[model samples]
Target: MALNNTYGARLVQQETALGAGVQILLLALLGSATGMGPAGWLTGLVFAVASWAVLSRAVHRSRLSSFGPANRVTLGRATLVGGVTALVADSFRGSPPVTLFVALTAVALVLDGVDGKVARRTGTSSALGARFDMEVDAFLILVLSVYVSAELGPWVLLIGGMRYAFVAAARVWPWLTAPLPPSTARKAVAAVQGVFLLVAASGVLPVMADAGVVAVALALLLWSFGRDVLWLWRQSRVVRQQGAGRVLESVAG
Candidate 1:
């Protein structure tokens, strides 16, 4: 048992170190390609360090025996995201090459589908893997929104900020923490946020058309979230009423 535990620890450390190494390599490439400024370099460093620390802690807590193949795909996607993030941050100083930015984001989005399939095929899916995947997706959307917001109005941030806002609200209203039933519509809505943002960022469409695309994405996201919130609220009320009835019956007895 001690040998097994030690081996697991070593494996986790190696995988995380590999990930950090990839991040550094990516940052170096970006700096050379785009002349990324201090802000971009700093942001990328912070992302790499934070990802290493948090993933290490989470893996330790979960007691994963190995880093797992599916997670490796997700880690690659995260590295791409780190590159996209640095580009966006550097954009404030000067515009990054749109082609480079779009390529990284596009590959990251494509691999989003690939990782889940890999997880299912390998039968290695876990709650931690799903959450990690979701978080990477969410942060990519958030970064894309920030980039687009520079061109569109700040209102564009609503698309990226909405999920985070929901998470924060759940802390205040515990009912919001209830698990939602799987819905295809919800998944589709979540998936499109990145696509639409990517399209807008690519500058392929006319300004008006890009704005329309983003607006539609935001509206769909709003509807999906609203439906889930309503469902959770109704379920919470049902539970409360059942509790109340049980109390009344006990009193009568």
Candidate 2:
């Protein structure tokens, strides 16, 4: 038990250190390529450290003996995300090299499924790991939305903010947090958000084409969220009715 505990702590520490190193390297690249300013560097560092803190907490809670191969892939993806974040921050100072920014995001998106496959193949799947993967995907989509929004208008933020809004709603309506059954449609919708956002940011598409692609992504996301919300509402209703039935039976007894 002591060995497992010690190993887990060390694993988290090592990964956190790696993330910090990547952040620094990416920062330097951004400075050279984009003329990143002090504010951009500060923002990127804060994002890197904040993400590390979340990973450490999740790892400790998981109590895993090692970081595992799957998690290593996720960490690699997260490193790429740090690079993307730094580039996005630098963009605020002035337009970043969009090609490099898009390339980092593209690699991160491609690796999204790799980590999940690695987890399945290696038998390392865990709730903590899944949640970590989902959040990274969410953050990437959110960042992409912010980048695209600068050109498309503020309405584009809805594409990125929807997941966060759902999470906030779950806090008020605990039933919304109920475990949802696996659905391919949900996965597909989530996957396409990054793709469409990438296309929008790639600058290869015409303005109308970008609008159309983003519109479709948003519609699918709305459908996905709507289905889940409806399912949770039905579940809550059933639970209430069952509780009422039990109360009536006790009174009769």
- Cα RMSD (Å) per model? 1.0, 1.4
Top candidate (TM-score)? 1
Q: Give residue 7's error in model 2 in angstroms.
A: 3.3
lDDT of 2 at 169: 97
Model 1 pairs in collision: none
Model 1 error, position 237 (Å): 0.5
Candidates in order, TM-scores: namely: 0.97, 0.95
Off by over 4 Å in 1: none
TM-score, model 2 to reference: 0.95
Q: For each candidate in the order shown, give its overall lDDT on alpha carbons.
A: 0.94, 0.87
